[model samples]
Target: MNVDFWNEKFTQTPGLYGEEPNRFLKIQLQSLSPGYLLLPGEGEGRNALFAASKGWKVLALDQSPIAKKHTLEKARKNGLDIEYQVCDIEKFIHEGTKFDVIALIYFHLPSSIRAQIHARFEAMIKENGLLIIEGFGKNQLKFSSGGPKNTEMLYAIKEIKSDFPGITWEYEFEGNDILNEGIGHSGEADLVRLVGRKLSDYLIKISN
Candidate 1:
């Protein structure tokens, strides 16, 4: 990913993306107790800052320095303290730390990289932890909303289930509608929404 491309994008006024938590994220986390939250591809920190406002200890990671700077500035403006890191998703290492909630919102990566990242995400979640994810589904290209033109970058239910079998589905579905994420994401879109909880020691074996 080109850091400059995103930097220049966020160089404009208020932010490239406005300061608001994702609607789906807010709803999913509403009933849960506050705890550590991981936000990958957390550009400009709008989501992270909002989560911090809700008492979540948020760790926002992005690849752009300008993104990090804007995130900190926005957090300070909101009187919130958020840990911001300038790091690419492919290079991130979680060590022994695990999160109660891991949110993946509109962060698209190549299929290979996504596979690796999904594995890491599974390892970084505490038992019974919730994983909330929203992304453009395969049908997104038919809509005018912002997203990659390539279908490979989009998500499918089967792909997610196969990749992270440890997560028991609480809710999973696809739909077409409006998405408000500022410049990069807006307008009529097709998306996949998932809210899942990590399974305990139980494991199911599938034969191909």
Candidate 2:
């Protein structure tokens, strides 16, 4: 999607994905210690703000300027400060920066570029860092709640395993579930959820 497309989406809805953090993401993040965290494709800053409030330094990236604006506004309202950037994932430069946790919730991209982006994120994670993901499954096309219409843009267990190789999967599953994330995502949905942890030294390194 282009900047204008997402900009319009964010502007059209007061809170497209709602003001609350994703339930799966919130529960997983709460189990870990506060540290540097990253949220990609974060619209309106719900998850970012939630992480910030929990004493985690959050850095959120999205292609929409409208998203950045709304996200910052919410952060300020909650007396929290977050680093939000408006840029395409294809052009984002990691600059050797690393994070303790990286969360991907409802973030989807074309199969043509998804693997590369996932690999890039994997490399940016510190040793033993966590990677939490929850997104639409191929079956989600049957539902209108949310997610990309293209099945190729959706996820499958094998695809995710291929994208983030070497990580120890603490949880991995593909199935259907109910979703109520603002007006954007609602009703029954097919989804893929994963929780993995990078290994430390003395452990076999997993390369994407």
Candidate 3:
């Protein structure tokens, strides 16, 4: 992720992406109770702001300092408190903390460290805690809605299963959807959406 490019882009467009949360994330919120939530690569704070509004203690991370400033400004305006940090995946220090829910909506990570991040996520959630991920599928190159132009940054269902092992995936979909979240994402999109729950070691074995 190039911080300079993002900083420049965000500086140009204050509301580059609209303020509405992703519809998929909004749907998941209907069933989930607010708690400690972590959002990685949370650009523009669309999801972070909504989660905070719902009483979730939100910790949002991104590589762009401008994104943090924008997010914090919005949080303040809305009277919602959210922690937005400008850090890369390597520098994010979360050792003894565990969260109730961790959402990765449209956060496209490079393939190099994606597996490691997925493994780390399994250990960071409380038992039976939720993990929600939505990204452009590998086949997304055909669509221009919005996503990493690089295929390596796109997700595949088989790869996802391998990345997040020892968990119960309650919902898994690798297909298409129409995204109208904001100016950043719109039109028909090829997407991969997964919602999983962390399980005990014994339970994982039994379920498998």
Q: Pick the candidate with the highest lDDT.
A: 2
- For model 3, how big is the CA root-mean-square deviation? 1.9
* Residue 149 C-alpha lDDT in model 2: 84
* Residue 68 lDDT (model 1): 88
Model 2, 1-208: lDDT tens digits are: 7888888898888798888999999999888899999999998899999999999999999998889999898888889989999888989887755889999998899999999999888888888999999999999989989999888889998988778875789998799999999989998999999999987634544331
lDDT on C-alpha atoms for all candidate structures = 0.83, 0.89, 0.86
Looking at model 3, residue 189 earns an lDDT score of 90
lDDT of candidate 3 over 108-143, digit per residue (tens): 778888888877877788888888989999888998
Per-residue CA lDDT of model 1 for 141-194, tens digit only, reads 898777778899899878976778788889997988787777667788999989
Give the TM-score comparing model 1 with the true structure, all chains together.
0.92
TM agreement with the true structure for every prediction: 0.92, 0.95, 0.94
- Superposing all C-alpha atoms, what RMSD in Å does each candidate have to the true structure? 2.2, 1.7, 1.9
Error of 3 at 14 (Å): 2.2
Score residue 176 of candidate 1 by CA lDDT: 84
Q: Write down the TM-score for model 2.
A: 0.95
In model 2, which runs have C-alpha deviations exceeding 4 angstroms? 201-208
Q: Indicate which candidate wins on TM-score.
A: 2
